[model samples]
Target: MKYLVMVQGSQADYDALGGKASAHSPAWSEKELRAMSSFMEELNNDLAESGEMVDGNGLAAPAATRLVGLGEDGRPVITDGPYGETKELLAGYWVLDCESLERVTEIAERVLRAPAPEGSPVYPVVIRPIPDAGGGDV
Candidate 1:
């Protein structure tokens, strides 16, 4: 079975990583950022070696996000993110092919252990199962 594991953050988190401080989070120092990044790389590499990692990627900052919807007249209307700095957003995700939900839960536990700056707030990693071609849940 396949699972989608998500990492959540806020615009303030991204800003901090880029050396910008906000009311929500402090600016991340170079050393802190390096450690965080290295941890992620190592985790991905381990998952890849285990053949459970199917796909994964980090998303761009909230500033670059766009929202598209249909206008009252049925035309597409696009707008910038306009997201609050403290609003939770998707920071990244990993797709893992695992033997059981327990395995995915274990992976999520490991993801939660990723390095972060001291006193940084932690968010729970979200996980959802991917259904097979049939409409039934796998």
Candidate 2:
């Protein structure tokens, strides 16, 4: 089965994540930064070797996002960025092809253990099996 693991972050705490630049920013000390990078690389390599990794990517900062909506008058309302509650922003995600939900859970546990800067709160990840949208057993 294929599963998509969403890395979710609360909008209220989004700004505290140092914004999107932190994804590639050198905000942490050299030692800490290096450790994080190494850890991520090792994790990717391990996943690739295990053949469970289908695709994954980190997202840009929310500030860079744009939202489009329609007003009650049927006029197109353009927004600068994500709308609604920031608490529901999807930070990033991974699509994994696993044999069972148990396997996906195992992978998620390992990912949750990944290194983050000190004092940063751990983000909760949502794991859901991807339903086959084709005309199959619904």
Candidate 3:
């Protein structure tokens, strides 16, 4: 089965855990950023070895997001960025091929416990299975 592991954090929480300013005014430290990248590489390597890694990447912050919606006239309206009221937003994601939901959960736990950039709080990680698109079997 395929699964998408989403990394999430609140804007306030993210700002509170500052490092180097990204496109945003504040960001994580270089050392911490390197650590995160290294951790991700290691995790990807492990998943590859296990034949479970499909693809993955670290994403840009949500402040740089763009939203598209329909205007009252039914024409497309492009917004500057996210407008959700929820505190938490998706930061990144990993696609995995796992044997079972239990296995996916295990991977999620490992990701959450992975080291963070110095001075930053651990962000929340969620694991969700990707539903089959109803195509014919591979």
Candidate 4:
């Protein structure tokens, strides 16, 4: 089965990684960022070697996000992200094809082990199964 494992974050988290502090998170140091990157890279490498990784990437800052949807009149509307009421946004994701739910669950837990700055805000790692092309949930 294929699973999408997503990491959540807030604008504060992005700002901190960019070396700016916010009320919700502290600035991250170069060393801290390097540690986090190394951890993620190692995990990706392991998944690739095991032939379980389909795709994965760390997303750009929330400031680069755009919200696109249809208006009440059925016209398209677009807006910048970190929308006023949304405290969290998707920070990254991994698509993994694994043999069992337990294996995927283990991978999600490893994502939680990624390093971060001392005062960084911790968000969730969400897991959702992808539906097969024939249309039912996988």
Candidate 3: worst-modelled 10 consecutive residues by lDDT: 16-25
Q: What TM-score would every model get versus the actual structure?
A: 0.93, 0.77, 0.76, 0.93
Clashing pairs in 4: none
Query: How do the candidates rank by lDDT, highest first?
Result: 4, 1, 3, 2
lDDT of 4 by residue, 3-112 (tens): 89999988888889889998899899999999998999999999999999999998988888999999999999999976869889888999999988899999999988
Question: Tens-digit lDDT track for model 2 on 7-96?
Answer: 865443355444332432323455655776687678778878999888988787566678888999999887875555554578778898
Identify the superior model by lDDT, candidate 2 or candidate 3: 3
- Model 1 C-alpha lDDT per residue in residues 1-138, reported as the tens digit of each score: 999999998878888899988777888899898988898999999999999999999999888899899999999999898466547888899999999999999999998888877767799999999998877585
Rate residue 25 of model 3 by lDDT.
Answer: 33
Give the per-residue Cα lDDT of candidate 2 at 4: 93
What ranges in model 4 sit over 4 Å off?
135-138
Candidates 1 and 2 compared by lDDT, better number: 1
lDDT of 3 by residue, 110-137 (tens): 8987666444556667887787889523
Give the alpha-carbon lDDT of every model: 0.89, 0.71, 0.74, 0.89
For model 2, the stretches where C-alpha displacement exceeds 4 angstroms are 10-27, 82-84, 135-138
Model 1 regions more than 4 Å off: none
Model 4: lDDT equals 0.89
RMSD (Cα, Å) for all candidates, in order, is 1.7, 4.3, 4.4, 1.4
Clashing pairs in 3: 19-27, 19-28, 20-27, 20-28
Clashes of each: 0, 2, 4, 0
